[model samples]
Target: MTSTPGNSTEKRQFHGDLIQLRGDRAAKAIWRRVPLASAGSENSIDEVALQEMLFRHADILALGEIDPAYRNSVPVCMELGTRAGAADALYLTPTGRIVLAEFKLWRNPEARREVVGQILDYARVLGSWSYDDLDREVRNRTQRSPCDIVSEAHSEVEEHIFIDNVARRLKRGEFLLLIIGDGIREGVRDIVAYVQEHSGLRFNLALIEAAVFRRGDGEDLIIQPRVLARTELVPRTVLVRKTILEETDDDPLEEHEPSPIEDENERFWRAVLEDFAFDDPEPEVPQPSRYGSVWVKVDGSGFGGWGLSFGAFLNRSQSGMGIYFTWRTGFPEEERVFDEIVGALSSNEELGSRLEGWKRWSAPSGPPRLGFSRNVEFVDGTTIRDFDEAVGWMREKFNRLVSVLHPECWRRLRAKG
Candidate 1:
């Protein structure tokens, strides 16, 4: 990320309050930072609780945002016993990449450095193992059945291929390392510099901030995960062949340095986020859907527990805005309201004209989409102004959508919900 005149990059942040609406009750929840320490008895969010919270909500790690290919990831185990010590959490992606995460609440500079060292040590120790060794350790530590270990997370991976891939990764010292803290406050430049100084190490590193917002009763919780910081990009790795040499039925390899096309995609989204400015009735503060997310939740707000977002799609070839018929599959009445809204939008002349050139794409296996969109291209020589113009178009149209649908249509639906 180089600096240019008049092109300052803002520190990415999750904006707005956590508003919860349950059973027609709308209670605005504030962004409550995790407490430092309890005054008396003991700390409420001890290290154990933090780990449990993270383990329970793996989405907090934002692995999908890091790499779209990591979609079907699953936690392998917690407190994975390593030669150095027990790492807080471990995950396995469908692509056979091992994601090791460690939880830390760093108050001082020294604690930050120590945590970085600990994470490196964990990665180093884990890097030095045979497939049998890694599998045996996972089997011994994990409460889940040994047979379900790889099959559950990645059913497509045969046991032999899974076994061989792990062995190869161990030999190559290739791993994705994460140093997670509760609402990271320190400047990321310093942590990135520290990781950069230790470039000899063979793993990609990232800094994540996991912010937890809870309701009064604590039963309802929302975790806003921010990649908050990143040190470097990992070479995109895909599950291709069992091994490079001695080809059998498998393809040779699906490994390569990150391509320029991907770099273009990331850069385009970053520009849109920085230049986002809405008009008319101001909505809630918007935030990136996730780390390296291609889209943003422009609505920054939702009614009936549904969000309206606008983002680049199809490798930046298309972009649009839409919200799903949320909570529709379960509660029949709520689904009715959402379905009615979708149906009304299609027939309502005023709303239908505004939605011209929009698309609602759906698949049998995936949720149905209801969006306003246009085809776009990010080919060679695409400028920052081009990115800004796209966002401006989205912003203007979104504002119009809000003005039309918000109070009249959305409020009515909210009342029914």
Candidate 2:
């Protein structure tokens, strides 16, 4: 992207067809478009196959620009049951954007029109849905709470706010509907124009054409997927998006100033998170807690147990920090994990040595949290002096702590258990 003194022309870095160049003996791999079709009974590359691929690798959609929060989205389900019909695929972002995608093999005009109309119908049906309505459908398929799905990716998102946002997004018809097709040839602009003309709906629609190229037969096959088209956002959709942005800026929580404690905690965590790299594929970001005890949740069990998570946290008084484990009384999930941890520390000498001198205490009640704590001197006025150095200590402890607790110990326990 570049511009002149007063005017500019938009051009994509790569367009037309894909080519592979590797020095002098290059520019030879033409990489012809491989139509996404069921060539015969032997192969199963059809519309359903395309949807599965998109579900598995959602990052391919290139939809992060519409809602940056979409980076934290997870695949909800494929063929999600809706009044209009089952959508091809459904994705839910942390911010509650209902990303409805419809995959199609656009080798004919009839197919394109059907996809556009079907997606529009899905959007219309979804618009009239309530939070419970959507949740019921999702749970029926994935057996996961709507909040649980997004919260797994973004625990910082409050459950109430997540539900509220999803309801609001649905009511307002603010969905990012993707019409994914195999080599969408011609009539693309018409689809964009069609969405624009429908002033009644406030939907952001994109026509993504996936150009899947193949080189060889079965075993030695090379496949590459490319996005050839994108969303040309319309004025109606843009206006709605602008309104949403304005509302976000005017959020009640953001409108107010933070308290002194909030300020201190904010600085403390920011210093740690700024340079503290987490190893979890989906590391949960920390939100400043009013009480000062906020954990940067990590999957402690290599087996993806929801309750099996513990992260570095500042003690309630901001005087100490630790790697805390969450344990709920009488809950099988947490109890089994706690049992495993105790057994590992006692039986495994190597594991015990790695976590040497780590203190532990538990109250005689439910929701007991155990961890290894490190105290920091909180002598300076509001926050500790040289908070940077304190954060450095915390980072070192967290990295070594997770490496010890999470994988090796947990993996061994999982196999044994």
Question: Per-candidate TM vs. native?
Answer: 0.49, 0.50
lDDT string, candidate 2, 251-349, tens digits: 322212344544676677677666555564354555533224445433554334445566565543336667656554445655666677777777888
lDDT of each: 0.56, 0.63
Largest lDDT belongs to which candidate? 2
Error of model 1, residue 161, in angstroms: 1.3
CA error at residue 109 for candidate 1, angstroms: 1.5
**Model 1, 207-261: lDDT tens per residue?**
8876766655455566677786665643323334653232222222322232343
Off by over 4 Å in 2: 1-32, 39-44, 65-69, 218-417
Model 1 reaches what TM-score against the true structure?
0.49
Minimum summed lDDT over a 10-residue window in model 1 is located at 315-324
Runs of candidate 1 with Cα error greater than 4 angstroms are 1-16, 20-43, 143-147, 233-417
C-alpha displacement of 127 in model 2, angstroms?
0.4
